[model samples]
Target chain A: MAESTKKKKKGGRKKSDAEMEVKAEEASEQADVSEETTDQEAIAAESAGDETTDEGDNQVAAPKRPDPDWQKAEKPDLSLDERLQGLEEDQLRQMMKDMLLARRFEEKAAEAYALGKIGGFCHLYIGQEAVVTGAVHAQTPDDYVMTAYREHAHALQVGMEPGVVMAELFGKETGCSRGKGGSMHMFDKERNYLGGHGIVGGQVPLALGVAWAIKYRKEERVMQVYMGEAAVNQGAFHESLNMAALWGLPVVFIVENNRFGMGTAWERASSLYDISQKSKAYAMPGRVADGMDVLDMYRVTKEAVDRAREDSGPTLIEARTYRFVGHSMSDPVHGVYRTKEDVEEHKEQKDPIRLFADVLDEAGIVSQEELEEMDDEAKRISAESVEFADEAPDPEPSALYEDVYANEDVNGRLYFDGRERP
Target chain B: MAEITYREALNQALAEEMERDPDVFLMGEEVGVYNGAYKVSKGLLDRFGEMRVVDTPITELGFTGLGVGSAMVGLRPVIEFMTYNFSILAFDQVVNSAAKLLSMSGGQFPIPITFRGPTGAALQLSAQHSQALEAMYAHFPGIKVVVPGTPADAKGLLKTSIRDDDPVAFFEGEMLYNIKGEVPEDEDFTIPLGVAEVKNEGSDVSIITHGKMVHVALQAAGKLAEDEVSAEVLDLRCLRPLDTDAILATVAKTNRVVILEEGWPYGGISTTLTTLIQEEAFDHLDAPILRVTQADVPMPYAKGLEKLAKPSVERVVEQVNKVLYR
Candidate 1:
């Protein structure tokens, strides 16, 4: 009887620790709950211009966001006429459908991988769908796009065939990289999507280089590079930013601040999490957006991308957002540092795709039946991709000799003397 | 034929290469209106103007990365560090980004960049300011390491480096720039990378060295000649993808070898050459390869101590004598 009482006492102790985590998440999503992390909230608010903290030296005031005076912003009148006004309800409805389908697809990827179907590090951009969807839909295929490893949504929303990407993830020869590069290395140079880079801050320099190339070749191309907030701490980020600013390269640096770097929250890892404030260090324009809201992400990114093409130099955009899943598929929500309450709160209260769909429904632009139809289409497409990946042939043994080098110096011959294609 | 200093030959190479390719340009701290820190690029700015010949700020990491980024975009940027010692600050851009880009990108990207500057020790420059990093750089791939020992080779190699499809570390010896030599009169002349030339051919034993140390070996060979030892001297122009065939062939013929490198003895170029000859040319029955290198200590400012720390003709002679006698 006494031992049973002790077990009950132990259970009570576990419940309150869980409660403290719940309180932390609620306090984090809504507003301040912890006094120690209050400075982060105040700075974030200042960055968005939602609040001002006048009494503090620690408070980094919102940047002087010299947004392009769009009325005076130069564009060929013919080009402006051709620009997608994004005013159509159908167009918005279509984007909403894609976003929702992507949401379901990612959530399923998490579940499917949990059953051991996916083998690699599978990072889901479930909460931040709007970042890519909004930006990708706004740009034409001629523009260049590159992003970090949390890139499945970037690839899908960029209109890369889902089947190819899924097949690539499965390490099949028919996949994007012919089974060599898994998820973090999907690239389509033909489409001007320069990469999917694995290193955190390494891509920043390379992308700026691409922009420099575009300008040098007199090609009117814009290079958009995506990275996380924690990557800003690295030296290459700062070094590249300074050169880009000085040279006035046509590049856009986007920071997907999903509130955490792997397991540590931005508050714990960053003194100033709002990357826009740090953009001042380069003397470039910095903008903030509700990363969960597609419309806001669209407006800001479009403005930045236009400025870049106009040869007005680079812009740094910090998308304030959250991630619904763990850093990767292998991580479990309960077993990790984050509480289940936090993930549940994001899934229930602030689902970006759901939020956008709700807006369209209120406007009567898209109905429940139309949405369900798109969901079925996406699910079938996803299922077909998985099947295609399973069927995709592995690379031939003779392919090892190819692409290792350019033509050799002697007689312009191939470098490797290996089995030829049979 | 024309006689010119290695410095003048280098300037001439830059002038000719820039004239040939509009995409080729140069940028460094003191290379422009201020001339060059080594006076190697003395009159380039007036000829090329501010766009092609740029004077950069003191941010080595920033500008070197800029040069690297610029190179990836089809611009052939010849970056001049004040010296190899200063290049350490931008080593990441040099080694990680430029050297590894071609291989890691799976050969999709080519960075046509060149980092040229004075390397190794000269006189009493002292420790923090002096180092010879040939072996360290030779360890990496996708980078071509060129150390020219003569005026003709310097000009020809510099020309070839500017046109190569890879990043090149073209190190000029500080003390050898003003040394005059007979250069080819043919304006269209060029030398390919990875080729070693026999500076002085003899049969008793082969003395191998690169950069300024090549001069030491040649002088030692002359001294050994008086003692009836016909010491062969090989000037290793390109260090990486080392003319191993040439080294091995010379060792096989001479049947004895002595390597002279300017850097400290530990993991120096001498060690690499000795290891390779022993492994590949072991049956050639060499009388134990001898390495004459800088003493295993930090270089001191005292002229006497600095001279003692570096490879000298006297030491080279002793090593050659040891190999031949043994």
Candidate 2:
């Protein structure tokens, strides 16, 4: 917390609009807990069992492998020079602008949800924008992208129109999926954006098919798929990872460890909390990236994308990040599994947008006026999207039967209830 | 036209389609080097190379989703489950991902894929290995369900399923693979989905059936002919876009109706046909519609119990006689 305060004033910088927003959250990082503490507690819990009270005898009988040093995987102090490698000023500005747009868009969506404009489970991407924005920046326009339900940021990063995405959330005919797929499902085939899949870890296997097509068609492209850290426990995750590695498919599997999957924390849900280490069983390179640092996410993902494009194999990346908001709009941001102080600590210390903005300032890259102008542009775009969504028309009643089957013209009757065909 | 076994006909259809479209590829357990567990894909590995003919591990859910994903990007993937019973492991991908992706994505992605394999009871495959799941797939809307009973129907319908722009669940009878019939030699021959054919012309009762039961109904028709009762055997090639017009036409042709099925009677194609006939063709009926289905229970392993559990020609004959009021 002291380090963040010192770094905030390193350049003696003025408080921009975005920085003022983060100052409101007032979050801090907790003291690091060593892995040895967990092991000792587990050993103590085992000794409490009726069958084994003698700790010395149990330790001698069953020896365990030394725990991996996962702390080394984090790049908290990624140098400014490394961050600027191959990045132009314009590109850097665009990335920051895109991240701001995603934040403003989610805020507007939250407002719309409260006004009853958008319905259903409305999950917001208020935080964790760096994870998708950085990863997507490393991918080509032809490269495919897929992710779980928390994906408004992903769609925006892949160049989907903010207005169309807002229209989808409004369930308007002008939306991305013509109003069918709402918050959890966003698709733009024109952009090679597969979708915002709702099922946990369900998009992993589908990414394999995209990679397979890349190889079959002799294209130099990679399929990047993202999922929550909790999804690593699913059978689909393991099955897909095994197949992707076994076949040398061009796929990059990224797990965004936002600490919690809904109400359950990652530690309580996974026996071995190091998700990247699980890739060892599949004979693939597993790397860790600082999800809070946009450049770190970009650097790690670019390496994996290059490997996939070269047909070397697939890579597993565990991006360490956190969510400042709840799992969805209906849930409380804190108090069920996490405390208010903990959420505040993350907001103050590891806010991705603030951290990236600070980096731009430290490098003397973007001026205060430019940053303010970018923030204004983001707000304007989000406001315009809301207006467009509000004015957009709802799908016609006859539109319901459309897309049920592509060959509906040739196939038998889709409806058995004898509803008149449109 | 050339006579070929149902297994060979299926192989020919796959080869012809793969030859026609580079996007069409075959993937399954033991499909490449193993030549398929049932030998349905024999010699495809050497012919198409390893890329087009993929032999994946025994991961049904994984490979099925892979097929759906590939289809999302305009690749026509034909995923084979060694047997339809094994498809239970992949119901989530088949039912949720493949069947619902088009409608859920608002037609953004039309999954041009096919899942084909042997279905129904094969000797003493018993409870776990033997199952006719066409009704389970037909229950869904986005996917088309095809159950071809004859070798000629198998070739024509399989070619059509492979070329279909939407997801199709193609069920081939395990017991009918070796049954030889005159299959067309033309590569362009494809029977459109949701169409039915009258296997036998009769003036008395209409025996409505599909898959393996079509043969049973045909046999019962032959037996009924000796008793001066000419029964028509109608084979429903596809179940989802069901041949309702053909079904009602047969109902009008013969007032008496007998529905036959190899799977469980409750909440299946048999139940669906009974409801359809009564609802739409109720006025055409002279006698109460009788259905001959597998005894309602889990298929037992014992020979006597298995025979009793399955729909047989004798059972069909009895139902036809009752429908004929003989």
Candidate 3:
């Protein structure tokens, strides 16, 4: 099967695509040679009467044949027009509008952080708008969504009011989490957006448990947990995947491979080149989607969601994407870990919002004037959200003691203790 | 009422809670098939089946966080750590996720999960295996730390901890599991948390303690009575909600007090109790409160050294003598 795929790739190469054919051939040959060498080493170790080393050696040793089941499925080669063929005009417009709204909202948040209006660890999701927008499109209101700290786009995409999110960023009483949780910890129970966890890979187990609860209740709702490529290295991630597969949980583990985890690039941090390959270890199907293409992401995630709803179990997805902005507002915009040229290249060519906008234009679903009108509308809404955040009251002083527990009397006794103790 | 071992009492509480609330479930290493490391969850898997009584892999952080997440979505999960020492592996989930989620999410989620396990020194279990971490858990605000002394208190407090609408760190004494005492037969009977009980009342020196050390305090009180010392043994059932009024009343009645705990002296529960006594009942105190604690060192493996490292009846008696000016 692998040989046929390689032959097909070679046969399809045009004379003008000579360089691409050479690169593909080189990659295939390199993989085959590495596998051959690993197998030879394992056999040599076995003949040497050192069976103790077999365990470690066998982990990297190549199998006798390529695993057709474990191999990643080929991504569709559909053109933008072909991919957008079946999508209704209204839904496509809505997707573009939501992406623009997320982009503009983060732009305003960045401006607020610069002005010191927002405080404490503001993680802007400027470059990753399409990933969440497409995922939200794939999910139902009954499904649960959770993510890492970079989650303003997720909250907004899940139908949280833009004003509430901005207010949360501003630390006002009217925020989604009532000002106690700032930018890193947005939660809305009504929407079933579980949380925006601060710790890396912290939400993996929670997503597993939520899926387990849904299963226990005999409900068809699925859980979607998002994390960065770097979080795939965490123990909790492996543990969660193991349990999710063991229990046949209804979950979709989405890894937004944004190329960088905080300041560290994925290449420097991960041992595995493709994060989706991790699913093979758990005996589950792994898929890779073009995260910059909203329709592709939606199509892939919607399939996984449907599979989970049918009690078919979990799926792991590695959404190949890039974050054009720095890791956070604290990171320099240029020339620290990443070069300015790289950022500019991604912004110009692979930006999700820009790519989606171009698709809309090619499809004639939206005109340039309509695009500008949507942009203006997004800007106006973002500006209004900022204004609302600015005028919203600071959390009342007594709020410091509230929400600590469900029982108010316990809070009172804890805060207003009459008994003096050293 | 029926006489039962503290281990049996804990098992009864788990069985009763699992029977009463369909939402309640138990999970831990060796809890289902192996019948628990200490047999505290013996026969529970048979009664509750595999779903409600689960045997998890050695992944502590994974299942602990799972319990926290399950509790958030309307389930009462009782997570067991084989020993409190093993719980250190899951401290991030316990502290950052379970304890702080309720407040961090602005009361949108309430974590009604109980992390229970055998704690403190148990015979020759070395430094890593033997640690009383009640005070460490009590230091956090959103978590309630419960340390039940007797079998009756164990069953009662375990039931209450399972039902409470907060994250609870129930540190059961390793040494007290086999100790037998009279426990109420009623399935609905429960003891409220944060309430101290007078295990043995007297008039001279007050011996304040909790967990397994309560047994030592009671034994020392019996010895002190022979010397006409009349020591009062006040068992603190819960550490976080330190029952200051009960502690102060005991101090006012007895005047001289000795705080005993089987934990490191530095920042131990005894230290907190001593400070509370001196601040609230200083005028009532006849002498400065003295604390009897484990030797400020890691528990050694040798039986003799382990005995020396923990709080014993002799040490409690000696502290009582000093507080009594004998």
Error of 2 at B177 (Å): 0.9
lDDT of 3 by residue, A1-422 (tens): 23224433443321211232344553553465345544545676579765433223233323232122111223566666557747789989999999999999999999999999999998887777878888778889889999999999999988899999999999999999989899999999999988889899988988888887887778889999999888999999999999888888899999998777788777567645566667868877676777877887886787678778875488898887778777889887654777898778778877888888888888888989999999999999999999999999998877876677654333112322443432
* Per-residue accuracy of model 1 over A87-199 as CA lDDT, tens digit each: 48766876776686577667666665766656778788878887888777666788878787888777777677777877777766667666555677776656666556676
* lDDT, residue B127, candidate 2: 91
Candidate 1 lDDT tens digits, B110-142: 688888999888777899777887777776656
Which DockQ-derived CAPRI band holds candidate 2?
medium
Ranking by DockQ: 2, 3, 1
Query: After aligning candidate 1 to the native by TM-score, how far in Å is the CA of A129 from where it should be?
Result: 2.7
Top candidate when judged by DockQ against the true structure: 2
Q: Score the docking of each candidate (DockQ).
A: 0.27, 0.72, 0.49
**lDDT score, candidate 3, position B291:** 88
Worst 10 residues of 2 chain B by lDDT: B317-326
Local lDDT at A303 for model 2: 68
- Interface CA RMSD, all predictions: 4.4, 1.1, 2.2
Off by over 4 Å in 3: A1-74, A79-82, A408-422
lDDT of 3 by residue, B211-240 (tens): 998888888988888888888898889886
Best by TM-score: 2
Model 2 Cα lDDT, one tens digit per residue, B1-326: 99899999999999999999999999999999999988899999999999999999988889998999999999999999999899899888888789878877788999999999988898887899878888888888888999999999999999999988999999999989899999999989999888999999998999999988888888888888998898999998888888899999999999999888888777888888888888888899999988888788888999999998899899888888887767
